[model samples]
Every structure is written in C-alpha cells, then in structure tokens.
Target: MAHFEKAKSIHDWLDQRLAIDKVNKVMQTEYWIPKNINFLWAMGMVLVITFMMLLVSGIFLLMYYQPNIATAFDSVNYTIMREVEFGWLWRHVHAVAASVVFLIIYIHMFTGIYYGSYKKGREMIWISGMLLFVAFSAEAFSGYMLPWGQMSYWAGMVITNLFSLGSLEMNGIVEWIRGDYVPAQAFLTRFFMLHVLLVPLAIMALIGIHFAALRIPHVNNQDGDEFDYDEESAKYLAGDTKGSKVIRFANDFLSKDLFVVAVYLIFFFYLVFWNYGFAMDPVNFDPADGLKTPAHIYPEWYFLWSYEILRPFSKDIGLMAFGFAQVIFVLLPFLDRSPNVAPANRRGPFAIWFWLMIVDLIALTAMGKLPPEGIFSTIGLYAAVTFIALWVALPFITMMEKKK
Candidate 1:
C-alpha cells in the first residue's frame, strides 16, 4: 500500500502536468499492439534509433569536417581520424553507421513487402515511408560527396548530370545544384548545407508525419489478418472499434523492441569498431581527380539494384525510368488491385512472382558490382526487365490467382 501510494502520487503529478493518461487513452493505445506481429515489427523503431545515432555522430563529424574541397579529404583522414580525440571512432561510426542504417532500412522495406503491410487503410503509412526513402537516398547521396574523394567526385558528376538532360531550365537547375560548372568547392559547400541541414530537417518532419499517420492506421501485422479488438474495448467508442485486434503499443512491443534494439546496437557498433570500412569503395580513399577517372565506378551496395536499372538505357530515358522507379514503389498500395492481404491466401503466381522479383533484385545488386559490359551487362538487362515485369504484372496475376 505504501508503494502504491508513491506510484499514485507520481502518476498524479505527471497527469496534472502533461495530461499523460488522457493522451494515451485518446490514442487508443493502452500500450497494446497486434500480437501477430513478429520481430519484423521492431525494424521501424530500430531505424528511428539509428537515425538518432547518425544525427549525434554527424554533429560531431561536422565540428571537425572542413567542407572546402582543398582540405576536405585531409581533414577527415588526418584531423578527424588521427588528430582529434575520439575523432577516429566518431568518423568510423558516421561512415559505417550510414551503411548499417541503409542495410536495415532495406530489410525493413522488404519485410513490409513480404507481409503486405501496405494493404488497405494503411496506404498513408507506406507512402510516408516511401517518401522517406526518397529523402533518405537524396540525403545519402549529398553526404557521400562531402568526402570529396575520387568516388565521390565521379559519382556526383554521374548522378548530378542526370539532372542536366532536360530543357534549358533543367540545365540551369543542374548548375544551381552544383553551384559551379563542375563539382568543386562551391558544390561541396552547397551539398554540405543540404546534407547537414535542409535534408535532416525534412526527414525529421516526415518522421513526425509518418508516426501521426501510423497511429491512425494503428499498425500492420504479419498475419495480414483482421484484428478483433472488440474483445477488449467492446464498451468503448464504436469509432475506435473500426480498427481492432489491437493491443497497447507499450505492452506487446516494448520488451521485444528493446531486445531487438539491443541486438542491433551491438552489431552496429561492432561494425564501427572492427570492420569500419568493409564494402566501401577503395577508390574513394584517393583524392578527387577529374583528369583521370577510376576504371569502373559504382554506388554504395544498397543503390546497386537501381544502378543496374539505369544501365540499359541512354541518360534521358534512364532518368525517366529511375524517376518512375523511385515513386512507383510507394504507390504499391494503389497499384496492386488484389483483395487478398496475405500472399498465402492466394494460391497462385502472385507468390511465385513475388519471390521472383526478390530474386531478380538480389541478382541485379550482385550484377551491379561486375563490369557493365559483355555477358554481365546482358544479364543485368535481363534481370532489370524481369524485375520490372513482375511488379507491372502483379495486379493481373493476382486477379487470376485462386483465393484460399
């Protein structure tokens, strides 16, 4: 009873000050969530935590990083890595954390795709996420140029020139983006501003909206089955009953989310400490030199799948294709006409096509690393075709599929 009184006093204090209980009760989350969701549900929270890590580490990195082209590379290699206290650790964390963040984000996306998490009533959640991906890609690309290395310079040129292919105004836009005729100190400064300031703000805003939208839909689960929340809230508002089978967010997910976060952090920091530069482009270590280019250039591995898609066409046409590719993914909720939420509910080519697309993507990512010539380019072209074909054909294929 003494302990109960103490807890009651604390609760009363918080309630009076913040209306804590009122918000929780109004949100319809008594900390409960759908019990059917597995470990995959934790991925979003992991992404949130990783973003926070990047922000903190990035702030420190900015303190030492000189955005000027002349000193950029040396500042990182010497000042950050060798001179500043714990600067090496922070630098590695920033560089390595970017890769880890992207890795998990890809998994989080695929995990959603596999479970049909975007189906009905949750379209906005998926759209917000997809838009977040767009913002994220732009953020990563801009940040990549900050190092001002050979890979950064060449990759920036290759990517930014894609914007140069349109009308006269489009070319002007390219110049505006670069801040010069070519990628130079001015370009780096502009990129630094976007990478460190504008983009992060955009991402934070999107994240807030994403969570707001998510709470409305309540959340999706692995079963793809309807939640039967009437069991718990039968006496409550009928409006809240529309999306049921829910549990309180704090109850079902908290422990599991924490456990996964712990594991993820361990693996993340392990990479930061032990294998900091794994899978990074070796050519990027060299200072940028426009006079001589690396024999072959490629993006970070997460982007390789899309890069392969870009390889088969001319600059203008490929830019069109890539543009479509970026937006179409988030539009999946509308694009797919199938009524069945779970892939298993349909016993037909939908599942086959789904796995095929996954395989095709994996193949394309692998092929991206190989030289885009001879037999390899041919294979990449075929793989890209297959990948696009599956997505394009999903609605019709699902229509023909037999429902269980």
Candidate 2:
C-alpha cells in the first residue's frame, strides 16, 4: 500500500482520486468556445435539458405503465392520468418535450447547414449528431407504441409493414420485428424494452460521442471564421479575456447557454400546460381496436416530410425515395463540393439551393398531413421529385461556387 496524505476536504479527496478538477478543466473550465456564436449554438444544451425531462418523466410514467396490451391503454389513460398524483403533469411534460425536442433538433440541424458547420474538419460532429437523430427517432417510435392507443397501434403496424420490401415479400422480417404476426403482447413487451431501456442507452452513448466530436473540432460560429483557437484561448487564460476572441466554456459560455435554455423552458412549459394537444394525437384517445381503422392514418408531424416522399410514388419507387431522404442527409459533408465554409447567403447558387430545399421540405410536410387526393396528391408528387432532384443537384451547384 502507498502512503497517503490527509485530505483537505471532500472535494479535494475526490479530486485527488477521481481527477474531478482535471475533468472540469478539460470539459468545462478550460474548454474554449468562440465568442462569435449566437443563441442557435445553445440548442445542444436545450436538447440535453429536454432529454433529461423525457428520461425523468418516462421513469415516473414507467412505474405505472403496464406492458400487457389488455391493460396498457387503461394504465396510461385512466390510471396514470386520473389515479396517480400529478401524473398528468408528468405525462404532459413528456408529451410536449417529445415533440419539442424534434423542433429544437431541426433548428439545430438547419443552423449547422446554414453556417456550413458540417464542412471540412467537423464531419464526425455531423455524423454523430445524425446518429443521435436516428437513435431518438427509434426511441420515439418505440415509446409511441407503449400507449396502445388507436394511432399508436396502427402507426406501428404501418411502419413495420414497410420491412416487407414490397414485391420481395420479406415479411418474416416484419413478423420478427413485431415478435408476432401483429402488434400484440410480444410486440408490446419488445417495444417497452426498447423504449424504457435499450434505445435510451443508445441515445446516451451517442450523445457522449457527439459531445466528444465537438470537443476536437470546437464549435462552428455564425461567421464561419477559422480563427486560431489555441492562441485566442491562451489570451483568455492569461487575463486578456475581454480582448480574446474566445471564452471559457464553464462560466462564460455556459451562462449564455443557460439564458437560452431559460427562454426555451418558458416556451416549453407554455406548451405543456396549455398547447400540448398538438403533441398528443386526438385519434390516440381511442383504445386500439384491430377491427377498426381510422379513415386517415398519419404519422406525427415531424415525420411528415419523409412520409410524403414515400406516399407519392409506386411502392418500390416510394421506398427508394424514402431511403434516399433518410441517407442523403448523412452524406451532406461530401455532397457539397464547395471549398468555402460560410453562411449560405454568401455562397452564390448554394443560397438558392438551401432555401429551395427548405421550402420543398415544408411543402412536403404540409401535403403529407392532408389526404393524398386531387391537388394535394399532385403537389406531394412534385415536392417528392423536387426533394430528390435537389440532393442530386447539390454537388454540381456547390462545385460551381467560387472559392471564398
């Protein structure tokens, strides 16, 4: 055994053993962030807060949630909402956070694209972020099934059936996924396992990877200026803080993040207390009945854009388009051939391309919610085609951008 010195205090003792001070220095105190960033940079913190809310509320809700199909509906609708004390509040927070998290994620993603944050050296940040997106999507889908409501059941059914691969007839994959021919006991149990355990763990791991990726590349700023971080950070550390172009991540940058998070919490609670109906589908109020199908079955709004891509074409073609939409975004760092790393407005045709893509996706989302008929069908088809065409055009349009 090694000789030991008497500890100064609990923190000192722990720091000596665990290197808490070093961790703080690395992850917080010494971590330098560019001062040129705006509130959009705070979305990562907001996402963490929202995910914490989801996890806490989910744990409380899970305490009373019954996985069995026969009791799952009543456990949520009656027992948790009406019987448990303040369970309704937890449910509302969860429902609103689940929806709002995606809103924040979209804003974060677009902000990244707009600022060219995904360009050059920060590919892992983008890729890890996309992986987090995929993990969260899976978590949401699995959680949606836990309610055992009409829309939940049918949405699960419809989404799972896609695994059948159209004419390829690989429905064994579907049944294997569902753990039965239908969304019954085994299906519910499997999804409950995923929602409550597996996917959340995956999300947490991906969040770690995402943050780690950010540490090396640092964060891209609004101006996309490639300043010397080491030099600026030295200035900050050496007491020229006001003159430095960077700030410590601990008190300086975190203060800004907290301000944005506070504002977001205000908006979030407003939804939870009053406007949460948007997050909870009205159709989900009904208990799942395999015999009854809603006249119009649609996914939650966040998924609408991609769903519309799959809606307009023939089955095989639709699947292809949908797959393209899903995978194309992950390939964005490679797709944009421009050497420049600046806001879209500064980049010639790329600016138009960015705005058009945004508008097209918005159009696709709107059409996805409406019944596919008459003018809606025609518009969705055009929008779907435009979406794929835009991605195909990205490399060529960006290649023409003059070096800046």
Per-prediction TM-score: 0.90, 0.98
At residue 74, give the lDDT of candidate 2.
95
Tens digits of lDDT, candidate 2, 1-404 = 76567889999888878889999999889998999988999999999999999999999999999999999999999999999999999999999999999999999999999999997899999999999999989988898998999999999999999999877889999999998999899999999999998999999999999999998888998788998988998998899999999998989999999999999999999999989999999999999999999999999989999999999999999998998999899999999999788999999899999899999999999999999999999999999999999999999999999998
Cand. 1 TM to true fold: 0.90
**What would the per-residue lDDT of candidate 1 be over residues 21-112, giving only the tens digit for each residue?**
88876654554467668888899889989898889999999999999999999998889889999998877778877888888888888777
Ten contiguous residues minimizing lDDT sum, candidate 1:
234-243
Query: What are the runs in model 1 whose C-alpha is more than 4 Å off?
Result: 1-14, 24-29, 166-170, 233-246, 343-347, 402-404
lDDT of 1 at 275: 79
